[model samples]
Target: MFKYFNPNKVFFITSKAPKYVLILFIIVFTIGLIESLILSPEDYKQSHSVRIMYVHVPAAWITLGIFSTITLFSVFGYIFKNPNFFLISKSLAPSGFIFNIIALVTGSIWGKPTWGTWWAWDARITSMLILALFYGIYLLAWRIYQTQDQAFKVTTIITILGIINIPIIKYSVDWWNTLHQPASINILSKSSIHESMLFPLIIMTAAFALFSLLIFLMKYNTELIKIKNKGLDRL
Candidate 1:
């Protein structure tokens, strides 16, 4: 099944994906903005400031999802001795890191009006900051290590350790006192959020996911090109 993971087999398809993805991203993003900014009802308390959720919530969700994906790929790459998996993980990190920062910044902006402060030591906020640091260290490991094997081993370890923070970030609101609000969206049960707001949130998340995919395709293609030039049979 994994044989199709080969760069030679997938390069043609991957190379052609960005333009189509970009068009879809533009369409979805435009709709999401219209729905979130104009159609979605304001919070009874927060008013228009609640609009920040359109960007912040989706960015945070994508950040967490991408990091989880990176860890899975890194672990599988190590176990199977498949360098291609590591390459995919490497290609994914930039977008995840970017969205992580977006989440933090937007959250801070949202916080000022909601929490009366721009920064806080709240559990969820601190945990997310920690996650960003882990992302930084993981990216730096790749740059600082002298060989592919060394970089792979170090990054695998970093992700393994960093994943411990994911649950902490997810549950911090429930586990302790925090300024951050409890989750309005729930997967196992009915969400507290109204359909009026939930619909736009979903669309925004799709737009962000498409944007992340676009970034990954570009980075992956660049790596593939480098491999082609270096005469590597697989990456």
Candidate 2:
């Protein structure tokens, strides 16, 4: 089964996906910007500054989502001896790290106006920062290790340990006294965010997801090329 995942075979299919993804990304992102910036209503208190939530929330969501996916791929790759999984995980890290930074920066920008501070030791904020650190360490492991086996094992361990932080980050606001507000969107119950704002948030999230997919394809293709250059037929 894993033989079917050969880099050559995979590249033939995935390499063609980026161009289409890029087109869709541009269309969705333009719509997201219009909906978020021009259509979404201002918060009763925060006014225009509230618009930052469109970016901050979606970036945070993407960061967490990507890390979870990285963890799954790493664990499964290690268990199944699938080098392709590691390649995919490695390709995903750049986008995850990028979104983590975006979330943190935009959070800080949103904070100055909302919390009246540029930075704080709030639980959610602190946990998010820790998640970003884990992303850094995971990416660093790939570069620092000389062998694929070594990198795979180390990154798997890092992701397994890092996943424990995900729950903490999700529940930090509820479990502690934090400047960060509790979640506005709930899966099992009615969300606090109005439909107008929620619609744009969802669109922005979709746009961001497409962008990450575009990045992953580009990185994955490069890795495949490297494998080909090394005269390897399969990953």
Candidate 3:
């Protein structure tokens, strides 16, 4: 459950990723843009607005994935007595929050044309809003607390407890009579989407994942520098 990793080891690994990762991201993301905008067929019902799925779905996926991973990292850090996980979680929280906002905003944009409203209190929407709240709190803990120990204690506990919402968020449309659509892609079963749509979805998801990694690494390196500075001050 716990992975004991040195903070410096993280910096070392991510430092090597910049040039290679960015180039690959650029290629894939450009292809993703073309696929979503020009190549993919318009939905008969939703029409062109259906294109929002490319960005909205990927953002939703990243929102859940990042939060769940942060919870796991928080748990491991607590169990292993490694603050590095907390630092990583701290770095990741902003990206997660950003994507959560994107998902909701884009969902609202898509909903206006399709569902006739900017917001709905469907199970999925409610849970996603809850997640955004927690993500805000998670980031605030790091900023508001004067000590890392205090911040970590609060954040680790909140993240571990709040992650319970992820499964609920994923399954909300299924469990409740909701306006939100059920997942088009199933991990256990084959995806329900056409190959054309699915291909772009995959590319966009990869591009987003790589983009997120770049963001996290930047924040992680900043945190490492701050920690180093603090250590020097103590000396």
Poorest 10 consecutive residues of model 3 by lDDT? 1-10
Predicted candidate 1 versus true structure: per-residue lDDT over 1-235, tens digit per residue? 7899988988999999999999999999999999999999999988999999999999999999999999999999999989899989999999999999999999999999898999999999999999999999998998899799999999999999999999999999999999999999999999998899999999999999999999999999998999999987766
Q: Candidate 2: give the clashing pairs.
A: none
lDDT of 1: 0.95
**Higher-lDDT candidate among 1 and 2?**
1
lDDT of each: 0.95, 0.95, 0.88
Candidate 2, RMSD to the unseen true structure: 1.0
User: Candidate 3, 15: how far from true, in Å?
Assistant: 2.3
Between candidates 2 and 3, the TM-score winner: 2
Tens digits of per-residue lDDT for model 2 on 86-196?
Answer: 999999999999999999999999888788899999899999999999999999999999898899999999999999999999999999899899999999999999898
Which model is ahead, 2 or 3, in terms of lDDT?
2
* lDDT for 118 (candidate 3): 94
Q: What is the TM-score of each candidate against the true structure?
A: 0.98, 0.98, 0.94
Query: Candidate 3 versus the native: TM-score?
Result: 0.94
lDDT of 3 by residue, 108-130 (tens): 99999899999999999999999
